[model samples]
Target chain A: MSKVMVVTSGKGGVGKTTSCASLGAALAQAGRNVVVVDFDVGLRNLDLVMGAERRVVFDLVNVVQGDAKLPQALIRDKRIDTLSLLPASQTRDKDALTEEGVGRVIDELREKFDWIVCDSPAGIDKGATLAMRFADLAVVVANPEVSSVRDSDRIIGLLDSKTRRAESGEAMEKHLLLTRLDAARAARGEMMKVEDVLEVLAIPLLGTVAESPDVLTASNLGCPITLHSPTSPAARAYTAAARKLLGETVTVTPAREKRGFMSLLFGKKAVLQ
Target chain B: MSILNFFSRNRSAPVARERLQLLLAHERTLAGKSDLVALLQREVLGVIARHIAIDPDKVIVKLDETGHVSTLEIDIEVPEGALARG
Candidate 1:
C-alpha cells in the first residue's frame, strides 16, 4: 500500500522543507517512486529548495482547479530519476485548496507513487490542517525548544481530530523530527535538550539533526542537503531518519558531550586558543 | 523562563537547550514580551478593577529582560483617589 506522509509542524523554520527534500531524495535514491508535494501555498519554497523553481509551469492548485493536468504539474528531478515535485502555486490564494480538490490530487498521487509526501505550512490554520488531512503518517518538525514543543502539542491535538484516520478515531502514525540541534550549546545549558522535547511531545522519535550551515548552503543553491552535502552530519542524520521512517531497526547516533545532563554543563570547549 | 531552563527542565537534567528554547519562543511571541505585555494587560486590569477604577490605558505589565534574570513589572497609574477606597 502507498503511504502519504505530511511533513508538518505547528511552527516554521524548523527544517520541514529541508526534511521533505532529503527524505524524498533518499527514498528515490533507493529506487522508490516518491513525489514531494509543497502545500505551503503562495510562499511556494519547495521548488527553489529542490532546484526546480525555474522549471515549474503548473502547480498543485493548477492540478486541483483543472487549470492543468497532473502530469503537467509534476516536475521530475534532474539529479534523481525516481524523485518528483508537485510544486505549490505562487499566485494562487491558499483558499484555492479545497478539501475535495486536494483529495483528488492526493488520490491520484497515491496510485502512481510509492510515497506521496506533503510539506505543510506552519501554524494550526486552514493551510496546515488541510495538508495533514489526507496523511496516513505525519512527520512533526520541531526545534528542540519549549515553544516549538508546545506548538507541536497543539498540532498533535489537531492531528487527532482533523485527519482521515482521526475522524475515524484511529491513531495517526506520527513521529518527531528535531532539527537545528547544537550539541555544544545544549551542553552549555543554552538550548532545549532532546530528551525534554521527546517527553512533552510523547511521539516516537524519528531522528535528530545537528545544526549545520550546510543546510543553509543547500537551500540557497536549491538542493536537498542529502544531495547538496550528503556527507555532512545533518544529511547523514536525515538519511538515518528516512530509514527509520521505513521501519528499519536503526540506532540513532547520540550527540557528543550529551552523555549525561549534568555532565554536559562543564564540558564547554572554550574557543580554540 | 530561559531557553536553558526550557531544556534543562524538559530533559529532567539542566542541560542547555538554547537553540530551540530561545529560537522557538522568540518565533512564537514574534516580538517577545511585547506580545505578552498585551495579554497580561487585559488580565491584570480585569482582575484589578474589582476594587479600584484604574485607567486601563495607563497600566503596563512588562518583562524586563535585562540583568541575568528576567523580571516582570506591573506599573499602574491609579486615578489619584482610586486606591483610597481600598
Candidate 2:
C-alpha cells in the first residue's frame, strides 16, 4: 500500500524542507517511486532545494484546482529517475488549498506514487493542518534546542489529534529527526543531548543530523544534500533514516564529526596547530 | 548535587519540558471542564425554562481549581419578577 508521510515542524527554520528533499531523494535512490510535495504555498522552496527551480510550470494549486493534470505538474528529477516534485504555488495563499481539492490531488498521487512526502509549512494554522491531514506517518524534524523541541511537542500533539488516522482511533506513526546537532556544544551542556530530546518528546529517534556547512552549500547549489555530498555526515544520517523508515533493522547511530578538509574548514577547534 | 544543579540552571530543555507539562495539563483540564459546563448549561437551561423566563445565552458556567479542589460557579440572568411569576 502507498503511504503518505509529512515532514513537519511547528516552528519555522527547523529543516522540514531540507528533510523532505533529502529523504525523498534517498528513498528514490533506493528504487522506490517518491514524490515530495511542497505544502508551503507562498514560500515555495522545495523545487529550489531539489534543483528544479527553473522547470516548474504547473504547481500543486493548479493540480488541486483542476487547472492542470498531475503529470503536467509533476517535475521529474534529472538526477534520480524515480524521484519527482510537486511544487507549490508562490503566488497563492493557504486558502487556495481547498479540502476537496487537496483530497483529489492526494488521491491521484496515492495511486501514482509509492510514497508521498508532504513538506509542511511552519505554524499550527490551516496550512500546517492541511499538510498533515492525510498523513499515515509523520517525520517531526526538530533542532536540539528548547524552543524547537517544545514546538515539536506541539506538532506531535497535532499529529495525534488532528489526523485522519487519529480521528479513526488508529495510531499515527511518528519519528523524530533531530537536526543541526552540535556534538561539541552538547557535550559542554550548551545544547540538549540526543537522549534528552528523545526523553522530552517521548518519540522514537529516526536519526541525528550533525551541524555541517555542507548542508548550506548543497542547498545553495540547489541540490539535495544526499545527492550533492553523499559521503557527508548529514547525508549518511538521512540515508540511514530512510533505510529505517523502510523497516530495515539497521543500528541507529549518532552523526559523526566530519574529518579531513571538512573538519579543517568548519570544525570548532583547528585540527592542526 | 546542589552545585551541579546550580550550574545546570541554564539548561533549556528541562525548563521547556516543565512548562509544556503544565500547559498541556491545564489545556486538557480546561477542555474537559468546558465540555462538562456545556452539558450542565443545557440541562440547567431546560429546567429553568420550565419554571421561569430567562435568557439562555446569558447563562454562564465556570470551573476554577485550586490544589485538589474545584469550584463550580453558575450565574443565570432572569428578568425581574420572572421567578416570582413562576
Candidate 3:
C-alpha cells in the first residue's frame, strides 16, 4: 500500500528536512518509488538539500495554483531512478497552499509513488497542520533537549486531534526520530539520554542520528547522507530507520561514544583526561 | 568522570526529563480537556436520550483536575414531570 508520511518537528533546526531527505532517499534506494515533498513553502530548502535547486523550474505552488501539472513540478533525482522531489516555492507564502489543493496533489502523487514524504515546517502553524493532514504516519523529529521534547509533546497532541485519521477515529501511527544526538555529551550527563527522551515522548523510537560532520558535509554537497557517505554512522542510522518503517524488526541501539586509539591503548583513564 | 562533574549542578539529562514530564502532563490535560468533555457530553446525551426525552442543552459535562486526580462531573437537569412520564 502507498503510505503518506510526514517528517515533522514542532521546534525548528532539529533536522526535519535532513530526515525527510535521508529517509526518502533510503526508501527509494530500497526499490520503492518515493517522492519527498517540501511543504515549507516560502522558506524552501529541500531542493538544495537534494541537489536539485537548479532544476526547479516548476514548484508546488505552481502546481497547486493550476499554473503547472504535478509531473512538471516533480524533479527526479539524478542518481536514484526511483527517487523524486516536489520542491516548494520560494516566492509564494504559506497561504498559497489550500487544503483542497494539497489533497488533490497528494492523491495524484499517491497513484504514482509508493511513499510520499512531506517535509513539514517547524511550529504548530497552518503549514505544519496541512502537511500532516493527509499523512498515514508521522516521524516526529526531536533533539535531546528540553524545548524540543516539549514542542514534540505539543505536536503529538496536535497529531491526535487534528489529522484526518484522528477525526475519522482511526489511530494515526507515529514514530519518534531523535536526531543530532551527541553520544559523548549524553554519556557525560550533559545531554539527555536516549532512554530519557523515550520516557517523556512515550512513542516507539524509529532511529537516532549521532552528531557528525558527515551530515553537514553531505548537506553542503547537496546530497543525501546515505549516498554521500554510505558507511557513515548517520547514513546507517537513516537506512535502519527506513527499514524499520518498512515493518522490519531491526534492533536500534543508541549511538555509543567512539573510543579513540589512544584511549584504547592507555585505558579509560587516559580518555577521561 | 571529570572533576568538573562535582562542580557542576544537577545532571541536565534527568532535569530535562523531569521538566518535560511535568510540562507534558500539564499540557496534555489542558489541551485534551475541552474536546474530551464535549465529546463525553454528546455521547452521554445520546445514551440518556435513548431512554428518556431530556433537554440536551441542560446537560453539563466537565473535567476538573485537582492535583493528580481528575473528576468527570456530569449534571443533567431533567424537566419537572419528565421523569413521571417515563
Candidate 4:
C-alpha cells in the first residue's frame, strides 16, 4: 500500500522542500518507488532542489485542471530511477489546487508509488491544507528557533484536526524533522537543543540536519545533499531519518558539530540564516 | 576554554524557548477550547453539576503543555456544601 507523507512546516525557509527532496531521493536509492510532489504553487522549489527544473513541461496545476495527464506531468529523476517529481505550477496561484482534483490525483498516485511525499507551502492556507488533506503521515520540518518551532506546533495541531485521517478518527503519525541544527551553537546555548525542541513541540524526532555548507553547495549544484555529498553529516542524518521512517531501529542523535577544521578549510560558516 | 563555549551565556535561546512554550499552550487551548469544552460540559461537567450546584458556562479548561505531557485543568465553581450533600 502507498503511504502519503506530507513534508510541511508552517513557516517558510525551514527546509521543507529540502527534506522532501532528500528523503524522496534516499528512499528511491533504497529501492522504494517515491514521488515528491511540489505544492508551493507560484514559488516552486522542489524541482530546483531535485535538479528537475528544466524537465518540467506540465505541472500539478496542468494535471489537476485536466490540461495534462498524470504520467505526462511526472518528471522521472535521471539519477534515481525509482524517484519522480510532480512540480507545482510557477504560473498558477494556490487556488488552482481544487479539493476534488487533489483527491483524484493522490488516489491515482497511491496505485503506482510506494510513497507520495507532498511538499507543502508555508502557512496554514488552502495550499498547505490541500497538500496535507490526504496524508497518511506528516514529517513536520522545524528549525531550532522559536518561530519555526511555534509554527510547526501549529502545523501539528492542523495535522491532528484538519486531516482526513483526523476527521475519520484515524491517527495521523507525525514526526519532527529538526533541520539547520548548529551543534556548536546548541552546545553554547545560542540555539535550542533538540531535546528542548522535542519538549516544546512534543513530537517524535525524525532526524536532525546540522548546519552544513554541504546543504548550500548541494542546493547550488541542484542535487539532493544525500546524492551530492553522501558522506556529509547532513546527508547521513537524512539517510538515517529515511531508515527510521521505514520503521528501522536507528538511534537518533543531533547532527555532529563540524565547524572548526571544516570551516577553516571551507572559509564559510555553516550557520542557519 | 574551548571556543565553542563563547556564546554559552547568551540568554536568547532560553527566552525563545519560554516564549514558544507559552505561545504553543495558548494556541493549542484556543484551537481546542470550543470542541473540548462542549464535550467535557456534556459528559463530565454535567455529572459533576448533578451532584453539586455549579455554573457550567464558567467552567474553564486550560491546557498547559509541559515537556511531552499536556495537563488539562477543569475549574468549575460550586456553592459551599454542594459536594458535602452528595
lDDT values, one for every candidate: 0.81, 0.86, 0.89, 0.87
The sequence of per-residue lDDT tens digits that candidate 1 reaches over residues A1-273 is: 899999998888888888899888877876789999999888889998999999999999999898899999999999998899999999977899999999999999988999999999988777898899999999998887766776887788778778998899888999988888876666454565677677556788888887777889989999888888888887888888888888788788754433444444544541210
* Local accuracy of candidate 4 as per-residue lDDT tens digits, A1-273: 899999999999999998899999998888899999999999999999888889999999999999999999999999989999999999989999899999999999999999999999998999999999999999999999988888898899999999999999999999989888877666556788888898898888888888789999999998999899999989998999999888899887558775565335433332331
For candidate 4, please provide the TM-score of chain A on its own.
0.94
Better of 1 and 4 by DockQ: 4
What digit string (tens of lDDT, one per residue) describes model 2 on residues A1-273?
A: 889999999999989999999999999988899999999999999999999999999999999888999999999999998999999999999999987888889999999999999999999998899999999999999997777877888889889888889999999999999899876555444466777777778899999998899999999999999899999889999999999999997676676554445334433441110
TM-score of chain B of 4: 0.53
DockQ of each two-chain model: 0.08, 0.16, 0.36, 0.34
- Model 1, stretches more than 4 Å misplaced? A255-265, A268-273, B1-86
A89, model 3: CA deviation in Å?
0.8
Which candidate's DockQ is highest? Answer: 3
Model 1 chain A is weakest, by summed lDDT over 10 consecutive residues, at A264-273
Considering only chain B, what TM-score does candidate 2 achieve? 0.64
Residue B53 Cα positional deviation in candidate 1, in Å, after optimal superposition: 22
lDDT of 2: 0.86
Per-residue accuracy of model 4 over B9-41 as CA lDDT, tens digit each: 564777788888877777886786667757866
Q: Which candidate would rank higher by lDDT, 1 or 3?
A: 3
